[model samples]
Target: MKDLFDYCEFGDLKLNSRIVRTGLWESEREKTGNLTPEIYNRYENIAASGVGLIITELYSLYPRDVFSKYSNTTNYARFVREARDLTDLVHVYDVPIFAQLGMVQYSKKTEQNIAIDDVSIEDIRKIQTDMIMAAQKFDYGGFDGIQIGLGNYYFLSRFINPNFNSRKDRYGGSTLNRLKIVLEIIKVIKETTNLHINCRLNAFDGTTNGMTLTETIEVAKILEKYGADSLQITRPRSPQFFTRENKEKNPLIEASEQIIKNVNIPVILGGGATTQNQINEILNTTDIDYISMQRPFVADPSFLVDWQLEGNGETKCKTCNNCYWKKTSTCFINRSAKWDVKSEIPKKS
Candidate 1:
């Protein structure tokens, strides 16, 4: 019988295990969006820690956006060539890596701030072009896959959510029309590149008018129809962080199971899975192809190693969102050793 540690296939990409390290915001990018040594070391640690697949922190397709100071895009060829070193390093550990591409909103500090949902058709087209170009460059950089991040309330997610998108134009009004931007991106990538494309769909949002699971499920079907290699079912971030008492029973599981049953493509489920037993139960019972974790990995990069060896043990992560405040995504519980950058930078959350 196949276990979580066993090899599996996601479209053309091969994985050493079923545990996936979902994209976490690591504010460790260089000026030109090149992979910094710190970021490289992080990936190396994650790859060496026994996770099967790794999705890198979101990379900005349009670097000039206001929120893109940390993640930027410049000369694709040069950036890709330089980034090949990080890819080769992770590959050495037999872990497949995926590059996540997202668009950023302008910060209040920027003079000409623009909201993600307020973008015009031409701007949307430009974003699609940037995304396609980024995907091509990531393929050149030796990534096993590229993930279209329609989660975390990013540009793509804003468009996908009815609550955020109020436009009556082609990019809004209806769910399919709202999804036009991402669908176009997927089509272009499939037609133009060899890199396997994955999508992180925001299945639900906490707000009243936010996207619903049914609509997201429909989107997943269309994504599969349009040649997406895999679907990662995620949701918009909760306003409050998690704790041991309020861990919320894998909030994404029910919807993810629905998506897995509907889509032919593999579905990666990640929400509040902190224990090995929860992971095993999810994989064994549901049709969910894999389990992805973000905070747990932040709290312990060797989480998979510990889980596999011990069979079952609670993660040390308290879900205290403290590490999320740092640009480096440091765990506050173990902040001293892993992230010791002493700076006066104000915490985000």
Candidate 2:
């Protein structure tokens, strides 16, 4: 039987477990966009906690984008040096980490929040260039991979969705045309850096004319064909979509299984799961081998350690989402005591 703690292979990278930790907001950073000591401490605990892979909190492409205030920015002067230190720290635990790069809006000079279709060809090139530059920084900083934020409501997500992208140029209409922007970026990143490219994509946007499962399956295949190393299936409003009140079967599980069958690359089912048994059930029942979690780690970065020991562990995270809504890394409900970085060093088993 497949277990959550089983060591496995994700593409060329070997993992200690099947749990891939995906991060969102980062409120612990210094005002100047540099990584703080608290942030490093948190990551150290998580890295030593038995995660398979780590996708860092959103590294905003633009310093002034919508989610930038709640995220880390690559524009800081100390980025590479500090990032190198952070990557080196995680490497101590043998956890491969990826820098999550994304932006919610596109603004140039006076123009604010430009629509997907309104962006000029020059704008397109600039976006791609910025992404490529960010990938190079990740490479220079010793990162193992790059998680391109194509999921959620990020600009690139909307840029590829037919409902939001009504452009007349070569970048719109057909699925291949809509995906041309990302495909081109992937090709260049592959040539320029050794970083593995993992695209976090929407299984279905749940919109009238937006991305559906059928189209997402097609997108997954094209990404595999064009050079993406792996994919993580997510929805428009995730984690929220899978709430406590809703006892229905998760659509993402089925969606992820379908996407896995359609592509040759590694596929990760993002969000919704909260326990050891639940995760193992999904693993043994479906083709999905990897599962990603976020808030549970915020509640306790070392929760997986207990899960490994107890065998039937469930997260202490209330799923209150206060960490998400407040845009902080620390949990509001579960901060019983501050973690002592020096005294709490996790030893490998």
Residue-level lDDT tens digits of model 2 in 125-230: 9999999999999999999999999999999999999999999999999999999999999999999999999999999998889999999999999999999999
What TM-score would candidate 1 get against the native?
0.87
Q: TM-score of predicted model 2?
A: 0.97
Query: Which of the numbered candidates is closest to the native, going by highest lDDT?
Result: 2
Q: Encode model 1's per-residue lDDT on 1-349: one tens digit a residue.
A: 4467767887767787888887656566655556677777777777876678998876766556634565545354468776689899989887889988876563333435476566767777777787787888888888888988787677778877888888878888887887887888888898888888888887688788887888888888888887888988776663243456774566778889888888788888865677877677778887776888788777766656555566686777787777555544557786555622123212222
Misplaced by over 4 Å in model 2 are 339-349
Alpha-carbon RMSD of each model: 6.5, 1.6
Q: Each candidate's lDDT (Cα)?
A: 0.74, 0.92
TM-scores, one per candidate: 0.87, 0.97
Candidate 1 Cα misplacement greater than 4 A, ranges? 64-67, 70-78, 106-118, 238-241, 337-349
Candidate 1, position 75, lDDT: 52
